[model samples]
Target: MEQPNSPEAAADRVLDAALMHVAFDGWTDATFRAAVLDSGVDAALAKALFPRGGLDLAIAYHRRGDTLMREALAKTDLSSMRFRDRVAHAVRLRIEAVEDREAVRRGTTLFALPLHAAEGARLIWGTADAIWDALGDASRDLNWYTKRATLSGVYSSTVLYWLGDDSLGHQATWDFLDRRIEDVMRFEKVKAQLRENPLSKAILSGPLKFMENIRKPVVPDDLPGRVMDRFRPKS
Candidate 1:
């Protein structure tokens, strides 16, 4: 009897084929194509199975890291942790997760996403930027130092710069992050002092007034009502 074509079967075939390609030939677009050929799966089916190609697989890897981070963060009291400690914890968790996932992928024929050196730098930097953005206002505090957007950006930039570093110990990136954090803390102290001064308060009032003037107009626009009407089902 012939086997039925189910979504699960199709998914398995794609994953199995992807693993095979990764194991025999390092992960690459050409390797992906070869996997399809080896599996005898049609091009259209393969495309449908993995629409975003290697990017989709890479994103899956990122999601796994995110899940681990979220779970870890949930158990910790962010309010009590020092900024550097928080950033270190998050980084360690992500690195460990990726290392574990890479090991699992290695055991299979599945090829990991083939990221060139530049592409890898971009991914790491982008991830740091994303974390900075997520931390938001909490990052501005000196106690929350390393997780600050500016500090994170520095860390990311250092990582990118270190990608090509051929020197012993790779100490440049670590030094950069440390110095950047210190500089940010110093600047924050200066800003805090200014915030406490009467002259700075007067100067800040002008910006506040400007923001007040930029408020949105309270026009009685009914565009939302029209949009809702269109979505409403007919009686």
Candidate 2:
């Protein structure tokens, strides 16, 4: 329900225009300028919308993919699927949401730079968080971090494999994903066994006590501090 000239709308316009140049320019300053010109948003306004230029646009594009994945997850019937299958479905939806492989390829290159590495990790974490949130994760403690952290590893590896996979229907990538998820399931099973064993649990009591205090992160919803919201990864 945003107005036509709202900042969000303008940002979307610039992003739409920038996508055309990302594959060729790899989300550089040149592409940012071209997008501003192509989007017909004032140069100053475009700058205000994306102060970091192409990097911000790339972040926006990645979040847009996450949003698309969330929407797809909402519409799909996942009730009949097993827990692991649902996780795989969500990851596949996230990857399949990509409109341009080359754009993501370029993004991978841009974010791989040491200067932008942290932002890249945040985006991946954001995606993993979105997948878990969409699937009705109720963990409020350390499990919240553990679930996303574990899935982040699975999702990142799967993406790398997917980019290189040219198999029919990317069956190879899906197979790789299943294997990775199975590995995680095995690890989780081991953790459960350790917790169930009295001796092992006693030995790890100190660390377990520390972990008990860890909780899910929360962003304040104060309206006056909304300007900083742009920097946050959308859920």
Candidate 3:
């Protein structure tokens, strides 16, 4: 039965329907349209609720999830946390958020890929690798947005792969994630090394000096001489 329509209620219905459609039919334009129709809402309202359609809704969901994760991250002193712990926390938060949403739709216990098992370990590692690449240099402004986008892309791809992976014990997907994490970790190490290198320091420092020079007004050669003359000790 269709829910009674308040603006908020109507929007919720659309989102609920859309998620169900994606779960069953996969995320596609046609599926989204079908979802809207199934939800028993006016098409105009659905279109307004999702301006770019299902893809937009999907992206919005990811963005909302990222926002939630970032809020949690902001409250923590990441410097105090070990790197692996931080990575694990971040990954787990994201996975749980997705699983919770899935539970709302499907009402089942979604299992975490076991971290100790070979396949499960691989999945965790691969996701971590992609996350590191997305994060880049740990600069709050640059790395945060980049990593969020990268994580979203990796997560979506991972979900798709998982759906299709029916191998014994679902080991194939886990193995794939493991390899992915290793590659990302290797790249992150290289990035960390480059940042720490003397040459990189010199290069970054050079730009700062150049900016300082540009900010100050260029003085005429006579200006220094005049200033010196004013300060000259009596002969």
Candidate 3 residue spans exceeding 4 A from truth: 1-6, 23-30, 60-81, 92-138, 141-161, 167-179, 199-235
TM-score of each: 0.48, 0.93, 0.48
For candidate 3, the 10 contiguous residues with the lowest summed lDDT are 104-113
Q: Give the Cα RMSD of candidate 1.
A: 9.9
Worst 10 residues of 2 by lDDT: 218-227
Specify the highest-TM-score model's number: 2
Q: Candidate 3 vs. truth: CA RMSD?
A: 16.8
Error of 3 at 221 (Å): 46
Candidate scoring better on lDDT of 1 and 2: 2
**Candidate 1, run of 10 with poorest lDDT:** 103-112
The residue pairs found clashing in candidate 2 are none
RMSD of each: 9.9, 3.2, 16.8
Model 3: how far residue 61 lies from native, Å: 4.7
96-134 per-residue lDDT for model 1 (tens digits): 444433323432223223534444445455556445544
